[model samples]
Target: MAHHFSPIKFDNKGNIRESVFSILRNAILDKKLEPGQRLVERNIAEQLGISRTPVREAIHKLELERLVTHIPRKGVVVTGFTKADIIEILVIRTSLEALICSIAASKIRPRELDRLELLAKQISDEHGKGNLKKSNQLNNKFHEIIYKTAESPRLYDFLNTLHEYITKFTEVAYSKPGRSEEVWLEHNEIIAALRNRDSLGAESAAKRHTENSSKAFLEMAF
Candidate 1:
């Protein structure tokens, strides 16, 4: 393998298999490992300075996640997101995000609303300064605050399953011209509804925001 994978650092508190899996998963999501590229367990283990068993286990986990696939003659290969996959994920996100925001509108505390306002302002400032990466991070924190305020652990866990894809899609969407500013405006709308404890209003705003995000991603990606 020509691509050099950073060696795995074994922290006392972390599981080896999980660490390996995370590293590989991030590489794939970040497009460092392109679609259809073959993965050799021995080479990866050697490059990461780890045992083959952990590498094998990590690949298996990735396969189960549909991030990689086992080919009869080609061994394991990266399975990058297809356009249909992206659409499906974004569609699901729109529904779930709207539901979460609706729940949060009713359940959110004053302190959480204050925090959301702070994050929203920071996100807008960063985007205005053309620091899109920072803006994206703050945007994530904005939604994270809402998710926490909703106090729905099961829903949060379900969303976590789509985390990687959502991250990728949002990053792409932010790269589109004018999208960041629109995102800032959309955030404000959601926050306004939350401040008033308007569940229906929050749901509508959240749905609009995600729908716009989906459109931006589609326009930019394909």
Candidate 2:
């Protein structure tokens, strides 16, 4: 088990338990700690140069986040989303993002609009260069701008939580064959709608973008 786990580098100023929790959470989200993989507290504590107490606390935190589960005999194992879970997330995202786009189309300021356009072009260029990771980050930035421009902090917070949970795995969806390029085109459509201040068109474009994204993730996941 020690061989399977990597030692965590802790920040000197950070609390041990919080650092442990962050490390473990990121490991789970990154899929290094795979679904159904048993977590050994002793091994983790030893590898991380920490006591079992902090490791236990970190495991508790992970459990709270639904990133890990405890079974009667299995102890704690990483959690994986089901096909149904993915589908439900996608459906919710499509609706919420469409609404966000509609609101943004009506409320977006010139500065924010300019930033969005720049991000779109940057994503397109990065995608053409086969820089999928940067392309995805820019893609997220573009949508995030719209969410911020919507002027609803609570709505953004809620959608952000949902996005975090599902996108941990689906971020790689853009790396699939031609998804990056397709996403650029979809982004352009969204920007065009927003530029025209066409609320309905913006909503439709966002819906279509999410639908295609959902399809890409589903195809890769299943």
Candidate 3:
């Protein structure tokens, strides 16, 4: 994994620290950097063709996000979520997501509704063809549209923080037999409620989707 990163090229536009942080964060989320894997600052620095300072800084940021841990004498390692952590995050996410869907149902425009339908159909097609990654991307796009339509920037930010941890294992959830098809059907229900502009129905569907996702993640992760 240390040699996985190519040489870093600075575009001089984005902050180097942030670039490093994002790279490391995505690697962790993508499972390229597995839980409990030790992170060697020197090796990472060499691989990215950068100094250890920014890598150290990035590790600290990931630590704050609870994606990494600084173990005494053992150095830093990736952190894995406990079952309790998963439950707590899902419980909060389910409620907040429901509210977000309710808000989106009221504010989403007709064009956006049509786009949602298009995305939903695409996801179903992708899943049928066994393209889980494309399906997941579309699924994320579907929810992101709802979050954007909700028009609550702060709420979106908070929800994303919760998502960082759970998002990593979503592929595993979808890989479970029949899970992807179930999720595709569930997303259609949510889209249906949104198209009808039924705030209550949208909220209920969103709630159920999250609950089912929680079960799938737990079954896969634990």
lDDT of 3: 0.84
Cα-based TM-score, every candidate: 0.90, 0.78, 0.82
Index of the highest-lDDT prediction: 1
lDDT tens readout by residue for model 2, 1-222: 323555666554268887787777777666787788888899898888778998999899788767889999879988955667667877988999999999899888888888988898898788888877787777778888999989999889878867555455447577678887788788889888988999999999999998998888877767
lDDT for each residue of candidate 1 in 113-162, tens digit (9 for 90 to 100): 88988998898889888888898888788888898889999999878777
Give the candidate order by descending TM-score: 1, 3, 2
For model 3, state the Cα shift of residue 100 in Å.
Answer: 1.2
Q: lDDT (0-100) at residue 18 of candidate 3?
A: 75
Clashing pairs in 3: none
Candidate 1 stretches greater than 4 Å from native: 10-15
Q: Cα deviation of 163 in candidate 3 (Å)?
A: 4.3
Comparing 2 and 3 by lDDT, which wins?
3
Candidates arranged by lDDT, highest first: 1, 3, 2
Best by TM-score: 1
* Candidate lDDT values, in order: 0.87, 0.81, 0.84
